[model samples]
Target chain A: MAHALEPQAKTLAETGPGASFGVIQGLDPRMRIVVASVFSIVTVSLSTIPGLIAALAVSIGVLLMSRLPIRRTLKRMAMMDSFIIFMLVLLPFTTPGDAMFNLFGFPASWQGLWKATEIALTANAVILSLMVLVGTMEPVTLGHALHKLRCPEALVHLLMFTIRYIEVLREEYMRLRAAMKVRGFRPGTNWHTYRSFGYLVGMMLVRAIERSERILAAMKCRGFSGRLLLLQEFNLTLRDYVFAATLCIVCIGLLCLDFA
Target chain B: MHIVDGALSNPVVIGGAIAAAGGIAMGLKSLDLDRIPTAGVLSASFFVASLIHVPIGPSSVHLILNGLAGLLLGWAAFPALFVGLLLQAVFFGFGGLTVLGINTVNIALPAVLTWIIFGRLIAKGTPVQGAVWGGIGGAFSIAATTAFVAVSLALSGDEFLPAAKLVLFAHVPVMAVEAVLTGFAILLARQVKPELFYKGASA
Candidate 1:
């Protein structure tokens, strides 16, 4: 049943080099994107605990199918959980419902506990499936897919540009930090530290702007216009159709269980 | 500061999505194709910048330099920051897919607001004056963001009221840190590259 989730990848024959994909990577990118969104909406609408658990199960099932590193992906999900744990903890005390227990003289209601659980399960399920489905794809292909899905052309170009330059700028950032470290910079609770960090960011922005200027010049010299030609053409294979069918059936089943 | 998928009510989610879509369209309209490269690179730099952890007493908070982004990108900050948030959700799972719209609105709206309110003053001032305005803009962005986040939560249900309040309180130090860093960053940019803040109103 975990085979309910699938993905799309661009191999050497399909696209180009640096393809890191797995079993379900043969599915269509647009299909994966649509399926993930549908799954999230369904998961969020789920009210019953069992229904939500089923939604999470389906997400894990997708994770298994996508062949992503299981432990690492789940750990990331847990990290997100850590972010909201405080709010979840506050829920049991805040919601006015039947008293379940006492925490520091405050009544923790069962309804509140259930609400917290519902949120955790829903959040985890939606995010888990999202990571496995779309996150597994190459960022460039994701941009192309969004473009094909009728996203604004300029927005897609921005996404592609950001993806291409993130690594470059990250290297520049590391080099800057290295320089700062060599200067015996130790961040602490002080104004100097803040100012230095501020200067660091300011420096990065200045360099980035200069780099972009050079890039624009290079593009112009190469006879480049403003348009970015999205060269990737996605075709829905048999596997993609099967994946879509399975997702539809599974989502319907979850909704049934939720309303039943 | 990303609210997860199931945490928000449908009305809040839908409203945020619509609002973000409108903001993004406006932002994109202001950005012609030629400026795409500039905006894209700046957006990436901000993405990397957010990874920086500035120490605050016993602990540290990661930077959210939306104010700085606004001071540079103006209306374009919406789409630029949305790209960052989208990458975070997909690649890192920091935020959820459904909540992307709302998260973008919460973070980027304050950025544009900062640009509008403080853009001109920072540009016309001396380096030190520009830095001070930059600092206030930075704090204002975070404060507005926290307020937006709080309102998004409180609108969902009465149960989220306390959490929303706590969210605001927890961000106090973050605002202070962002302000100082943003001020210094603006100060440096003004001295070194004076055009940075000057372009804020129309970028």
Candidate 2:
């Protein structure tokens, strides 16, 4: 898991238009957020096998055309597969159903098994589709999306600031951890060590707050407006309308197939 | 704990979105500029803290600073959390886009509740007790919320017993670690930058 996150972190550090598809990459950041958010909602609402299959198909089609590497995208999906699978495995035992097999002198119901399998598949499919959606979108795009959604200006500003300071706080945490390692501070199940960790986190917060204050102050000193400058413009182009309509049509078609 | 998109039902996911938006609206109503940096820093802390995963018996769990969030930000933790979770969902795919709202509520609700309860508890001027209870509150609040999340997921017509037990049991050690970390963080604030805890100490 740690290994998986490292590449993602690196990928994030190396973000640029050259690294992503022209459409997804070029779309206003806010628009991408809106599209991704809407797509995710549409994807998760799908439960039936056919419905999920259609959503998964649309997601995969998007991914293939998005210009991102399939290997990297699959790795992202595979990284999270374990946790979703772990959650899914429990479905068969818990969902009500007819007997399938005896486990430790208990009958495992067939109905339970089928229900579990369906739910598991649905969960995995939805998760995978959503992963593809997010994996293709950028953070700035998401912020822009929230802004467009009429999210409060204060909230939008805070999110932007939070993104700006992620690296700074991350650096502080690394330095602190290294210091702890140098001090031979191996945290055990002891009160003293626990207290030390808490102190580090609290102190980190204080330092972060101090740094943010200076940063915000410096920005304000430069005639900072309440809004950060967003340069990208996304209009309702023919392509965007086509994309939305096709998505709805595909989703509806899948629902019909499932019921049929 | 990041929830990936499509992992939850649409209704639950949509409900979470509405709730997160509502929480942010209420939080915005009470915003002060002085608190902006604190909120931003807390969001950063929340993001970074999630990256640190302590090993425990074949499964490793990371720190979630929702408790710390409550201790510092109180009511405003909600919007900070909503945005943070959304960011995590987008960049890391740690949680899914569909379930962003639910995941945010799961983590932020405890922090908000802790703030409500701990706000009064800490105001009594007992640093040590405050830190201790704050630690306890942080620990139990998250655990309680996780349990609720599991049970809710189970009851969502998608099987219940095994999954619920697995999730709840898996979090036991994680909660302990959180308590310890939250406790120590507060204690440190008391000692070095004591003003973070008490207003007129040295600010």
Best TM-score among the predictions, by candidate number: 1
lDDT of 2 at B152: 52
* Model 1 TM-score, all chains together: 0.95
lDDT by residue (tens digit), candidate 2, A1-260: 11226734454534655565645554444444455556555556655666666666777787776766678666766666666677656555665667777677666677666655555455445555554555555555556666777877788778877876777778788899899999898865566666677777777877876776787688678877665576665566666666666666776676677677
Where is model 2 chain A poorest over a 10-residue stretch in terms of lDDT? A1-10
Give candidate 1's error at residue B187 in angstroms: 0.4
Best by DockQ: 1
- The sequence of per-residue lDDT tens digits that candidate 2 reaches over residues B35-96 is 67667777877778777766555556777878778667766788888877766555544556
DockQ for the candidate 2 complex?
A: 0.53
